[model samples]
Target: MLLGVVLTVLCLPFLWWYFFLQKFKSLSAIPGPRPLPLIGNALDVGDTPTALFNNCAKLLDQYGDIFKVFIANECKVFIANADFLEEIMTSNVHITKSNGYYLLKPFLNFGLLTSSGSKWKRRRKLITPTFHFKILDQFLDIFNASSDILVKKLFNEVGKESTDVCPYIHLFSLDVICETAMGVKISSQEGKNSEYVNSLIHYFDIFIVRFFSAWRRFDFLFKFAPEYPIQEKYLETLQKFSTSVIKKRRLEKSQEVVETTSDLGIKRRVALLDLLLESDDLTNDDIKEEINTFMFEGHDTTASGVTFALLALAENPEVQQKVYDEVLAVVGDETYVSMQHLQDTKYLEMVIKEVQRKYGAVPFVERQLEMDATIRGVHFPRGTTLNLYLYGVHHNEKYFPEPEKFDPDRFLPHRQSERHNYAFVPFSAGPRNCVGQKFAMLAMKVIIIKILKTFKIIQVPDHKPQLGMAAVLKSYNGVRIRLIRRDTD
Candidate 1:
C-alpha cells in the first residue's frame, strides 16, 4: 500500500505530461511515426548520422508541410514548404535557433555559425565586412595561386596515368584553406609526407570524428562526454598552430622580410587570419572560435561541392564540353582566368548553382527557438526542434520543375529566382546565410577555371563513390575521376 502510493507519485508528472497535456494539443494534423512510451521519437532519430530521417517526402505528402516528431519526449517540427520556411526564417515570426544546436557547443563554441540573439547579431556585423566583395577580391590572388598548384599536382598524377580526381581536389582544397585561413602555406597537394599539412589534417580528422559520435546524441546523459577530450586536443592543436603562425608572421614582418617564389607571389595582401586578428570585439577565444569555424568551413564543403560538380560534369560529358567550349570562346587562350573572366563564365556559374540544387554538400540547417512561438498556425512551445529540411525542400518538384534533371538552363537569364524564396537554399537564406559563401565560390571558380583550362575532367572505371555523414556529407572513398590533361603534354 505504502509502495503503491510512492510509485503513483513518481509516475504522475510524466503520465499527465504525456497523456493529458499532449492529447489536448492538435498534433493530429502533423504526420510522423508513432511516438514511443516516454522516449517519443527517440527511436526514429537514428543513432548514426548515416541513417537519414526516413521517407520524409512520403510523410510530408501524407501529413502536410508542417509535421511533428517527438524525440525523447521533445516535440520536433519539420518544415517543408516555402511559406512555412519563410515564417520561421523571415521576419513574419521571431523564431530563433533550436536548442538542438547546443550539441555543437563542445566542438564549435559560440562561433557565428552557432550563436543566438544579440551576440550573434554583433558578431555577424563585425565579420560581415571581412568577407565583403572588395575583401574577397583581395583573396582572389591566393585563390588563383592555390588553384594552379592543385592543377599542376593533378596534371603530374594524370601524367602518370592516374584514374581519379576526387582525392586530388580534396588535397588541393585543404592546402588552399590552410593557406587562406592560417596564412600558412602547407602543400597538402604533396601528400601527408609534409609536416605542416600532416599536423593540420591530424587535428581536422579528429574534429570531424568528434562531431557525429554517440556522445553527441545523448549529451544530457554523460557527466562529461568523450568530445571533451577530443575538443581539448583540437583546441590545443588550433592554439599551437595559430600561435606559431602569428609569432612567425610578426617576427617576419619585424625583420621586413619578403617571402616566396614566382608562383606564390611575393606577398599575401589579405587572408582569413588577418580578418580575425583585425576584427575588434573578438576576444582570444572568440578569435580562436572564428578561426576554427573558418578553417573547417573554408575547406570541406567547398571541396565536396567541387567534387560533386565535377562528378556531375563527368557523368554528362556534353555539359562538360559545353563548359569547356564556353571557356575557350570567352577566355580564348588566356593563360590564367581573371575576375572578369569568372563573371563571364555564366554557364559555369549556372552549373555550380544546379549542382548545389541537386547535391548540396549540407542537407539541413538547424535553429533554436528564442521563446514560445507560433509556426504555420501551430503554437510551438519553447525549445521545440525546428529544421529547414534542406533535401526535401530542394528536390520538391514544384520548386525545381524536373528536380532530378541536370539542367543549368533552369537558372538562366530573365528567370527571377524571387518566385521561390525557400525553394533552393544551398547556402541557406537571409542575413544568417553563410559568411564564407563568397569566399568558397571564388575559390571554386579559380580552381575550376585553371583545371579546366589545363585538363578535361573525366570519369574513372571503378567509380563507386559512397558518402558517410561527417560534419558534412563527404566521400568515404573520395571522388574517383581521371583528369586527362588537354593537349596531352
Candidate 2:
C-alpha cells in the first residue's frame, strides 16, 4: 500500500499537466524555443542573473517582435511592437500586474505597484493629487538643496581619475526621495553608510535571485533556502525603519503647528505621506506601503536614468557641449535651478529624452490577462502573461534608425511629432503609467543641469560598461566618467 501511494503521488503532476494544462495549448502556435515536458525552456534561459539577462537579449534578436517562452508550462508572451504594446497597455481588463510582481509583495505589500482591481484604483486616486504641479513645485526646495550637496560632492572628485558616478548619484536620488516623499532627512550625501539603505540594497539583491530561480518561488522552499535568512533580516530592518518613520510622522501631523510660505506667497509644506495621512479610508499599513513604494520607485529608477545620461554625454562631447550651452543660455550662473529654467531648457530636455530611449530605467512592464483577448489578429487566452519589452521596443531599428547611436536630435519636436505616440514610452503609456514621472523628469533635469553648469564630463577611452538587468537596468561595472571643472576651462 505504501509503495502504491508513493508511485501515485509521483504520477499526479504529469497527469495534471497532460489532462488540464496541455489542453489549452494556445501558445504552442506561438514561436519560441522548444520546451521539454515539465521544464519548458527553463534550462535554456540561464539560472544566473547575468546569463538570464544575456539570454533575454539573445532571444529578442532571434525572435522578432512577438514570441512565447514558457516558465514551467506558464506562457509568457513577449511583445516588442508599439501597436501591440498600446493595445495591451490601454485595455481596462489587462490592468492587473503579472505574477512576477509577487516577489515585490513582501516589501511593497498592497501598495500601488503590486495592488490590483479596486484597491489599485483607490490607491491611484488617493495618491494622484500629491504629484500635482503645485505639490511637486513645492518639492523644488528639497531638489535644489540636494543638488547643491551633490555638486559639492562631485566637486571633490573633480580632476581625479575617472570615478564611478553611480554611488554618488544613487545617494543624491535617495536623499531627494526621502526628503520629498517622507519629510525626513537621512543625509545620504554625507558619505556615511545608512543601515536602512544597506538593507534596501540587500533586499533587492535577494529579490533578483529569487525572481530568476523557479524553485525559490515556492514559499515552502524559499523559507528554507540559504538566502532566506538574509532576505528576512533585511526585510525586517526596512519594515522597522519605515514603520518608525510613519508613526513619527503621524504623531507630528497631529500636533504640527508650523507652515511656510513659498516665493509665490502660497502656504505649503506637504509630502506624499501627508496626502495619504489625509485619507480616512487608508490604514497605517496602507500609508507605510505607499511610502515604501515611492521610496523604491522614485530613487533607484531616477539614479539609473541620470547615471546613464551622464555616461551618454561623456561619450558624445558635441551633444554634451550643446546641453551645457543650453543650460548657460537659460540659467547662467544661477545658484539654483528654477521651475522657469526647467521649462526653458529645451536642448537639455531633448538630451534626457534620448537617454531614456536608449536606456529606460525599468526595462519592462508586465500585465496578466484576466479575460481572453485578441490583439492584432492574435488571440491570447486567459491566464497568459504579457511581458512588454520596453527596452526591445526602444532599441528596435524600425522605430529608431541607427538605434545604438547617441543622438539627441532624434527627439526634436518635429521628428517626435511624426512618430507613433507609443513608439517612445520611457515612462510608458496608457492609464496605468508611472504617476511620479513628472517629478522624476524634473529631478533629472535639475541634477543634470547643475552638473553641466559646473563641469565638463569626459569619457574614459574604450571602457564603456556592458548593460545588465536587475530591479532596474544597470552597468555590470559602474558608469565611470571624469569631471573637469568648468572654472578651470
Candidate 3:
C-alpha cells in the first residue's frame, strides 16, 4: 500500500505532461515561432511592454493571421484575421475571458469585465439599464462640468513648447468616471498628488508588471516577488476606497438625500451606484467589485483614447482642421454641446472612429474556448485561449491601405462598407464587449471638442509618443504636444 501511494505521487507530473503534449498535438496544424521548453514562447514575447508590443507585431508579420504559442504550457492561439475574430467574439458559448483575467480578480473581483457564465450575464443585464440613452444624456452635464475643469487645467500648458497630455487626461477621466458611475466625486484632478491617486496609479503599474513577468503570473510565485507587498498595499487602499464609497452612498440613500432632480427642477438621473443600491439582489461587496471594474475600465481606456486622438490630430494637420471645421459647423459657437450637437458632428465621428482603428486604446482582448473549434480548417482544442489581436487586425494592409497613415476618411460610408465588421474593434465586439462604449464615445467627444475649441493641438516635430501596453495602451514617455490657445469670437 505504501509503495502504491509513492508510485501514484510520482506519476502525477508525467500525467500532466502527457495531457499537455496531447493538447499541443491537437493544435500542431497552426503555425508559430518555435517555443522553448517549460517557459514556451514567453521570452519571445519579451518582458517589457514596448518590447512585448513590438515583438507581437513581428510575430504577426512573420506568421500571418493565425498562430499559436504556449506560455508555461498553456496554449494561446492568436487571431488577427477578421473571420476568426468574428467567430469567437460573437459566439455565446465561448464567452469566458482568458485565464490572464484571473490576475484582476483581486482588484476587480468577478465584475462584468472579469466574470463569466451566468453571473456575468446577470450582472450585465443589471448594469445595462444604467447606461440607457436618457441616463446618458443626463450624464452629459457631469461630462461637460468635468471637461470644463480639464480645459481650465490646460491653461497652464498653453505656451509651453510641448506638454504631455496623458497625466492631465488621466485625472480628467478619473473625475468623470467617479461622478457618473460611482456616485462620488473624489476630486482626483485637484488632488492628483494625493496618496489615494498615487496608489491607484501604482496599482495599475504593478498589475501590468505581473502580467508580463512569467515568474510572477502565478499567485504562488508572485508572493515571493517585491511587487507583491507593494501591490497588496495599493490594492488594500483601492478596496478600502471602494468599500467606503459604497457605505457612504448607502448612508445617503437611507437619509433620502439622493436627489432625482436638479436645482432648476428638471428631472435628473441617478448614478449607476444608485441603481445598484436600489436592487435588492446585489450586496455591498458586489457593488464594490463593479465600482473598481468601471473605475479602471472607464477611466484608463478613455484617457488612452483621448490622449492618442490629440497626438494623432497634432501629427495630422489636415485631419485636425477638418475635425475643427466639423465641430464649428455643428456646434456654432455654443459653449456647451447638447446631444444633437454630438450626433451632428458626423465628420468628427469619423475621426474618432479612425482614432479607434489606428490607435486602439485597448490593444487586444482574450477569450478561453469551452469547446473544440475549427476555424479556416485549423483545429483549436477546448481550453485554447483566443487572443483577438485588435492591433494586428487594424494594421492589416489588406483592410486598411497605408495602415500607418492617419486618415479619418477610412471610415467614410463607402470605405467602411468595404471591410469586415470585425476589422476595427477598439471597444471589442459582440456579447462580452465593453458596456460603456457609448459613454466613452460621448465623454471623448466632449473633451476633444472642448480642447479643440480652446486650443489648437500642435505636434512637436522631433518628439514622438512611446507606446506601451498595460491594462490599456499608454505612452510610457507621455503623449507630448504643444497647445496654442484659440481665439474664439
Candidate 4:
C-alpha cells in the first residue's frame, strides 16, 4: 500500500502537466473574455444564443478578430472578419464540421449531419449526387404544387384574418421534402397536424437544451446511459414514415424491373430516394441516414429562407411590386409554375438572395480544426471550435456598403457585384456547403413567383415580424401578411 501510494503520487504530476498545460498554453498570450472559475461564460450567456454570438462579435471590436470565450465547457474562438472566415473555410479540411456537434449525435446518430471522418466521407460521397442540378426540376414541381396548397389554404381563411404564416410555410417545406425526397405527398398544409414532423422538430430543442444545460453532452451520456427510447421513438417514426413510402416505391419499381426485363426497357417515376437507393456505394443503413438528413436539412433551412424572403418582401413594397411585375410578365397562363417559369423569375431570385444575405437562415457554419490552420495571421490550435459569425459578417459595412439596407441589386451581374465569395453565404461555404443549393433556390423562386403573381402582400397592422433565432432563424410569431388577390394587371 505504501509503494502503490508512492507510484500514484509520482504519476499524477505527468497527467496534470499533459492535460492542464494546454489549457493555459499558447493562447494565454492572446486576450479573450475573462472566464469565471468553473462556470465561465455559461452563466452570462443566459438563454440568448444569437445575442451571445452578436456580443461575441462586439468583443472583436475590443479584442480583434480572434478571441476566445469559455462557452459551455470549452474556449471557443469567434472569427468575425470575412478574410479570416474565407481563409479558414476555403483552406480547411472538408471534414471540419465541429466536434461540439456531438450535441446532435443523439438525434442524428453517426448520421451524416453529426458524423465525422470515414463515415462522413463515405456517406457524403454516396448522397452528394442525389442533389445534382439536373434533378432540381422535380423538386421545383414539388415546391410549386405545395405553394399552391399553402396559398389556397391561406386564401380560404382570408377575411382580413391574417395570421403568422411561418408554421404554414414550414408545413409546405416539410410536405415538399416528403414528395421530392421520399416519394410521399404528406398533405401537411391541408391538415396541419404532423405528429412525426412535430416530433422530429421537438427533438432539436430537447437536444439543444440538454447540450447547454446538462452535465453530459447529449451523446457522451448516451454512450453509457442511453436515452429513454425518445430518440428511438423518433427514429422509428421517421423510419416508418420513410420506409412505408420506400416500400411502395420499391413495389412500383419492382414492376418496372420486371417490365424492363420483359417489355422493352420502359422507365418508372424516379425520385431523390430512387437515385440514392439505386446507388452502388450506400448500404440500407446509409440510405436511411441520408433520408433522415434530408428530412432535417430540407425543411428547416428551405422553410427559414422562404419565410425570411416573404418577410423581407412584406416589409418592402417596392421590392414586392418589382417581383410581382417580373412574375406576371414572365410566367405564362398556368395555375402553377413549371421549372422554366422558376428560372425566368429573375427579380424573385434577387429578393431571395438579398433576404438570405440580410437575415441568413442558418447564420453561421461552424468548423473544428482538422489540422493547425492560420486564419488571418492568427493560428487556431488544433481541435479549437470556430464560429463563422455569418450574421455578423453579413451585417458588416466593410464588405457590404450600407449593410443594414436591404438591397437586391448586390446580386445583379454588373455594377454592384459580389465583394467576397464568403460575403453572402446563406447557404454556407466550402466542399461541405449545402448540396441542394440550386434546388433550394429553385424551390424559393417557385413559391415567391406563385405568391407574387397572385397576391399583393401587405403586412397586418398587429403583426410585426421579429427575427426569432433557434437552431435556425424564423419568426417566433409567424409572419402575418394580408394578401389581396391582384384583380387586374
Using TM-score as the measure, which candidate wins? 2
**Model 1 CA deviation exceeding 4 Å by range:** 1-27, 53-65, 92-95, 156-164, 192-231, 246-265, 416-418, 460-464, 467-470
lDDT of 1 by residue, 1-489 (tens): 999999999898678667643642654666777876666655565544444433455556666666777755456677777777776666523535655555556546777887767887888888888888887776677788778777777756674444556667777888777777767677767665255445455655654454444454455643376545655665566567766776565455446552332235565566666666665566656776676667667777898788888888877789999998988888888776777888889999989888887777776676656567766677766566677777667777677777768988877765635457777777877777888888888788778778778887777766766655544656666676767778864
Give candidate 3's TM-score: 0.94
RMSD of candidate 1 to true structure, Å: 3.9
lDDT of each: 0.69, 0.85, 0.86, 0.70
TM-score between model 4 and native:
0.86
Each candidate: RMSD to true structure?
3.9, 2.7, 3.1, 4.6
Per-residue lDDT of 1-489 in model 2, one digit per residue for the tens? 999999999999878667544644766667788866677778777776566667877888898778788777577887778999888778777898888788988899879888889889888888888899998898888898998899999988988888999999999999999888887778988955488888887788888888888889777899989999998889999999889878877776677631444335666478788888888998789899999999888998999999999999999999998998889899998888899999999998999999999988988888888888888887788888898888888888778998889988998889999887888998878878899999999999999998988899999887778787756888878999999999997
Cα lDDT for residue 123, candidate 4: 74
lDDT of 4 at 74: 58
Stretches of model 4 off by over 4 angstroms after superposition? 1-25, 28-31, 49-65, 92-94, 220-232, 247-252, 255-268, 415-418, 461-464
Greater-TM-score candidate between 3 and 4 = 3
Query: Using TM-score as the measure, what is the rank order of every candidate, best first?
Result: 2, 3, 4, 1
lDDT score for residue 323 of model 2: 90
Candidate with better lDDT, 1 vs 4: 4
TM-score of each: 0.85, 0.94, 0.94, 0.86
Native-vs-model 1 lDDT?
A: 0.69
The alpha-carbon lDDT assigned to residue 17 of candidate 3 equals: 61
